[model samples]
Target: MKNLRVLDLTSCVDLLVTPKFSGCKNLAILILERCSQLVEVDHSIGDLKCLISLNLKFCTELSMLPVEMGHLTALKELLMDGTKVEEIPISIGQFKQLEGPIATLPDSVGELIRLNHLSVRDCHRIRKLPNSIGNIGISLVELDVSGTGVSKFPNSIKYLQKLKVLRMDSCFFKEFPPDIGELTSLEEIHASWCRSLEGGIPSEIGKLHNLRILRLRHSTISSIPMEIHQLSNLQTLDLLHCDMIKELPRLPSSIRELHVDDELKSSEIWILDNLRLQRLSTSKLPAMIKLSNLQTRRLLHCNTIKEVPKLPSGMMDLRVGDELKSSKIWNLHDLRLELLSTFIIQEEIQLSDPDLVDYFAAP
Candidate 1:
């Protein structure tokens, strides 16, 4: 009876603890996803030497892993995405095949060269990544240190040649490494909201030919290097709340989504023309009615918005600050408006149009 190969008990809401799987010698996959009440796993599960994937996502009650979890020699993928787990067993580094977060990444992490995806979101204690992390460059596909205390990255970071996604939002990284473009496989770089991060972006950013999305929103980035226009594949660029950036350079036509502050001059806004723009957010809406493909428009609060430009008739979503006084100047009765309450400005709005009411709060 020890031949169980796959065990899926996903969404077992009432289950508080994992049963022993020690006897399942051939077990390959064990999925306990969305088991909201699951608090802990029996350490004996470590005996499943052939186990490959263990998914425990959405187990909010789970705060710790069994100390013996590192013994799963053959386990490859371990997902605990939404759990409250604060720390992982460092012996996990001995897993050799382990992948992916918290206070401090053990230096032994270098031992798991099979590690691919690692995320340490909101771990305030970790000051830096283990220099040994560079050992898994060939297999590390994504690395995120968003909302952490990491003030600097190890020099070994330049070795992540195969990495695709690198997000360091709200971290302590004072100055971004200039050699980030060395990660030639990178497709997205989200480093927004780091108040301490103040500096001109490196021109080497242009070297990331594969980059597709770049967000430096609510940050102190002084200005976007002209080299940013070199990102031929970049489709989204967010610089909202960056008070230092006076105006954006002429962007590549590949841009489909752009978010900027209200201070941008009207003259500098028109240069983003006839591209693949699908959505745009700014203080004063741009006159890009020709972006027929544009579906979403978010206008920030601008006290001087005298008139609303003719927006796309096919627009699916329209978000404007409650302070927008030119409501009567725009024609929005025909479009389907979908706006979330969170994006709605905390103010009153007096609108008789039922269509607009769905997206705007009444005064």
Candidate 2:
């Protein structure tokens, strides 16, 4: 099999140990996707110096990669999502074309000057990234480290001048590094669930001229810099559960989707002017209903909202909390009511509504 060029061993349910594929010296692509029972890749894999692509997606039972895997110098692409692999060997930095989701690369990973497109999603155990990662400079393209336990980004990240997309969702960073503005080529960023983040967002964030999407959900952010309005290319902004955020600056005219929490006060609602804005969530409906652009609005767990606000004639879908008084629902053209739990509706409402009979019937 030394001359074999492609080998796909995907979804082999009983496959436990890694197969001896190193004999395929000329192998260009090897895929082992959804092999849930796989435990480890054999060290002999290093002998496949001609391998270009390797995929190990959804191998939930996998624990680690072979330490000698770094010797596959000809490898170009690698994908390992939903695996238990804990540590990436430092020797991996020697691979000039390695790409894809890796939680923690070896400190020497900067040596892969030709590497591009790294995605490290749901790696909850990682605490930090290699400091030398910045050395890759303009060669790197996309970096996605969402759902990791990282608290801080390596300062070297600013050196990736060619980075286009950065997704750092659920990172526990208390604050973003000031140097983040240096990634001039960045186009999108997802930094949701950074609960401890404090201070206002850097005004310089608007400097990324190509930025299109910014997601900062479940963060402790108290205020957004007025400079945020400068992101002319911005299309979607998701700010769910930013409990301390007191107000919003005028949104960029290009924004189309805005998802916010239910607790925003009346004053904070004035800044929204997205003519195409479609999604909204709040504790109470506003007193002055003028949602000509609204398509979907969900009011969650707000007990005090006794009456639904007047919606625009164009409004299509409306979801209201269960606490509101029951009525023959004829007024709302496309209204959908989702009743809340007795505990969530309000502390005062003790009498359980018979419509809630479904809640107690759930398995």
Candidate with maximal lDDT: 1
RMSD of each: 9.7, 10.1
lDDT of every predicted structure (CA atoms)? 0.74, 0.70
lDDT by residue (tens digit), candidate 2, 1-363: 777998888999898987787577788888899999999888778888888888888899887888788888887667777777767777786564433345566778778788777656666676787888898886888887777777888888889999988878777888876776789888888888877788878888878878888888887877788878888888888887888887787778677667666566455464443345444444455555445565555444333455555554444444555665545222443332353222233334332334443443455
* TM value for model 2: 0.68
Error of 1 at 316 (Å): 22
Deviation (Å) of 353 in candidate 2: 44
Q: Give residue 250's lDDT in candidate 2 (0 to 100).
A: 70
TM per candidate comes to 0.67, 0.68
Give per-residue CA lDDT, model 1, range 1-363, as digits (tens): 498899999999999999987678789999999999999899888898898899888887988899888888887777767777767788876453322235656777887777787776766666888998889899889888888888888899889998999989998777877778788899999989878876888888889989999988888878777887788899988888888788777677788788776677556555654464456665455554344556665444334454565655566666655665443556554555654322433234344456666545444
Q: Which stretches of candidate 1 lie over 4 Å from their true place?
A: 4-20, 28-43, 53-67, 76-87, 94-101, 283-363
